[model samples]
Target chain A: MAQEHTVKSYDEELNQLRSMISRMGGLAEAQLTGAIEALTERNAEKAQRIIAADRSLDILEQEIESQAIQMIALRSPMADDLREIVAAIKISSTLERIADYAKNVAKRSIVLNQSEHVKPAVLIPQMVELTKVMLKDALDAYIDRDAQKTIMVWESDKGVDELYNSLFRELLTYMMENPRLITPCTHILFIAKNIERIGDHVTNLAEIVYYQVKGETLDMNRPKSDDTSFAVVPPPANT
Target chain B: MAQEHTVKSYDEELNQLRSMISRMGGLAEAQLTGAIEALTERNAEKAQRIIAADRSLDILEQEIESQAIQMIALRSPMADDLREIVAAIKISSTLERIADYAKNVAKRSIVLNQSEHVKPAVLIPQMVELTKVMLKDALDAYIDRDAQKTIMVWESDKGVDELYNSLFRELLTYMMENPRLITPCTHILFIAKNIERIGDHVTNLAEIVYYQVKGETLDMNRPKSDDTSFAVVPPPANT
Candidate 1:
C-alpha cells in the first residue's frame, strides 16, 4: 500500500510539473501577444505592463526548477521519467527566455512609440504572429508528446527567418533613405531582431520536445535562412 | 566493499562531469577570443574558422548533458552530488550559447571585413576583452565553488553594459554623420550587442555557480544597467 501510494504521488508530481509548464507556455504566449499588440497600437502603457509581467514568468521558472530538482532527488525516476523532468527544466527556461525577448520587445516598443513610426515596423507583427503560432504548436507538441508536431514547428522557423531577412533589408534601406528615420528605425531593427530571436527559442522548444519524446537529438543543421549577416546594401548613389 | 566501490565510482563520475564542464568553458573562451581577433584584424578566413569551430562546443555540450543525465540516473546522486550534475548541465548549455554568440560575431565580422572600416569598430574589441575576463572568472568560481568570485563576476557585468551603451551611442552618431558607414556600423552594433549578451550569460553562470555552492538562489535583481533600449540619438542637426 505504501509503495502504491508513493507511485501515485510521483505520478501526481509529474502531472503537476506538466501543468506548470503548460501554464508557463500560456503566460509566455500572452506576453508575446501583449507585446505585439502594444507595438502595433503604439501603446507604451500596455508595453509597461508586459515588461512588469515578465517577473512572474521568471519566478515561475525558478519554482519549476526547484520542483524538478526536488523530484529528482526524492523520486529517483529513471529513463523516460528522468527525460521528462529534464525536459521540463529546459522547456521552462526556454519559455522564460521567450518572455525575456517579449519583455525586450515591449521595452523597445516604448522607445519606438516616442519616435515617428517607421513603415517597416508593420512587418514585425506578421513575423511575430507566425512565431506565436509556432510557440503554441511547440507547447502543444510537448503536452501531447507529439514528435510530428514538433517537427512541423521545427520546419516553420525557416519561414520566420526569411521574414526577418527581408525586414532587415527594408529597415536598413529605410534608414539610409531618410536620415531622420535612423533613431526610430534602429529600435525597430532591434524589435524585429528580438522577435526573430523568439522564433529561434521556439524552435529550441521544438527540439526539446522532440528529444524528450523520441530520446534523440534533432538534426543540428536545421534549415536556416536569416542571411542578414552577409547582407550589404550600398549607400544611395547620391549619398 | 561493493558499497565502497560504488561510492568511489560515483565520485569519479562527478569529477568527470566537472572536468568536461571546464573543458567546455575553455573552448568557449577560445572561441570568443578568436572571434574578437578575427573582428579586430578583419580576417575573414580566421572568422570562417571560428564559425566552423562552434560545432565542437555544441558537441561537447551534448556530451556533458548526457554524462550528467547518466550520472543522475545510474548513481541516484543525492544532495550536493545531484546539484553538481544539474549545474554541469546548465553551465554547459550556457557555454554552448556563448559559443553560438561568438559564431554570430564571426559571421558578421566576415561581412564587416568587406566594408570600409568604421571607427566605432575599435570599441568592440575592448568590450569583448572585458567580457572574456568575466567568462573566465565565472568558470573559475564554478570549479572552485567560490561564491565570492561569482559575486565579483556578477558585479562586473555592469561594466560591459556601460561600454555597450556608450558604443551604441557612438555608432549611432557615426552612422548619422556618415551614411556610408551604416552597413558596417550596423554589424559593429550587433557585435557589441552579442558581447553584451555574453556578459549577461556570464552573469547567469555566476548565479548558477553560486546556487550550486550555497544551495540558494541569488537575488534575481542583480545590478543591470543596459539602457540602450531607452536611448535616442537624433541625427546630426545638419542632416
Candidate 2:
C-alpha cells in the first residue's frame, strides 16, 4: 500500500510538471501571435508588451529546469517516468527558444513601426495562426501522450514552410518593385522567418514526443529533397 | 595507489575529450570560412564541397557526444569534470548548429551562383572571418579553461552583430534600387543572417565556458548593446 502511494505521488508530480510546461507553451504561442499582430497593426505598445512578457517565461524555464533536476535526484525514475522527465527538459528548452524568436519578431516590429507599412501583412498572420495551432497541438499531444497527434503536428510544419517560402518570394518582389520600401520589408522578412522557426520548434517537440514514446531516436534534421515523407527516419544503421 | 591510478586514467580521458572537441571546433571554423569564400566567389563547386563537408562534422559531433556520455556514466565525475562534460554536450550542439548555418550560407550561394553578383559580397566575408576567430578563441578558452579569453570572445560578438545590421541595410538598399536584383540580393541577406547566427552560437559556447569556470550563469539573452565588461549575474533572488 505504501509503494502504491509513492507511485501515485510520482505520477501526480509528473502531471503537474507537464501542466506547467503546457501553460508556458500557451504563453509562448500567444506571444508569437501577438507579436505578428503588433507588427501588422503597427502597435508598438503591444510589441513591447510581448517583449516584457518573455521575462516571466524565462523565469519559469529556470524554475522548471531546477525542479526537474530535483525530481531526477530524488525519485531516480526509470523507464517511462525517466522518459517523461527528459521530454520535459527538451520541451522547456525548445519553448524558451520559441519565446526568444517571438521576442525578436516583436523587436523588429518595433523597428518597422517608424516606417510605412510595406504590404498588407496578410500571409504572415495566416502563417502565424497555423504555427500557433501546431504549437498548441504539439503541447496537447504531450499532455495527453497522444503520439498520433504529435505526428500530425510534425507533418503540419511542411505547410508552414511552404507558406514561408511563398511569403519570401512575394516580399522579394515588393523590395524589387520599390527601392524605397526595402527597410520595412526586410524587417518584415525577419518577422516571417521567426514564425517559420517557431514551426520548426514545434516539429522538434513532436520528435521528442515520438522518441519518449518509442524509446528510439528521431531524425530532427532538415528534410532532404530525396525524402518523400517528413516522417522521422529511424536511427542510422551504424547506431 | 588505486586512487592515484584512477586519477591518472581520468586525466587521460579528460585530455583526450578536450582534444577531440578542439579538433571538431577547428573543422567547424574552417567550414564557416569556406562557406563564406564560396559565397563571395560565387563558386558553385566550392559551395557543393562545403555542403558535403558538413557530413563529417555531423559524424564528429555524434562521436564526441557519445564519448562524453560514456565518460559521465563511467566516471561519475563531480565538480569541474562533471561541468566539463556538460559543457562538451552544449558546445557540440552549438558547433553542429554553426555548421548548419554555414550550410545554409552555402546553399544560398548555390542559388546565387547563376545570378549576377549583387554587392561584391564584401561585408559578409569580413563578418564570417570575425565569427571564425571568435569560435577559435572560444575553443581555446575551453581547452585552457581561460575564463578571461572566453569573456573577450563574448564581447566580440557585438561587433559581428553590428556588421550584420549594416549588411542588412546595404542589401535592402540594393534590392530597392534595382528590382531586377531582388532574387540574388535576398540570397545574400540570408547568408548574412546565417553568419550572424553563427556568431551568436559562438557566443553561446563562450557563455558555457563562463559557467564551467565560474559556476555562475551569464545572461545570454541580454542585447549586446555596447557592453564590453563581463560580470557574473547571480541566480534569481527567489531561487
TM-score of each: 0.95, 0.84
- Model 1 CA deviation exceeding 4 Å by range: A1-8, B1-8
Error of 1 at B120 (Å): 1.1
Residues A1-239, model 1: lDDT tens digits:
43555445787899999999999999999999999999899899999999999999999998999898778777778888999998999999999999999999999988888898788877898999899999999999998999999999999999999999998888888878888888888888888899999998999999999999998889668878889999998888888
Worst 10 residues of 2 chain B by lDDT: B226-235
Cα lDDT, model 2, residue B214: 83
- State the lDDT of candidate 2 residue by residue for A82-180, as single tens digits: 667767767888899999999888888777777767763689888888988899998888778788898888888888888777777677666655556
Candidate number 2, chain A TM-score: 0.86
What is residue A191's positional error in candidate 1, in angstroms? 0.7
Q: Which candidate wins on TM-score?
A: 1
lDDT of 2 at B205: 92
B28-109 in candidate 2: lDDT tens per residue? 8888888888877878899999999999888888788667655664566766777787678678878988998998888878
Candidate 2 regions with alpha-carbon error over 4 angstroms: A1-16, A69-79, A219-239, B1-16, B59-76, B219-239
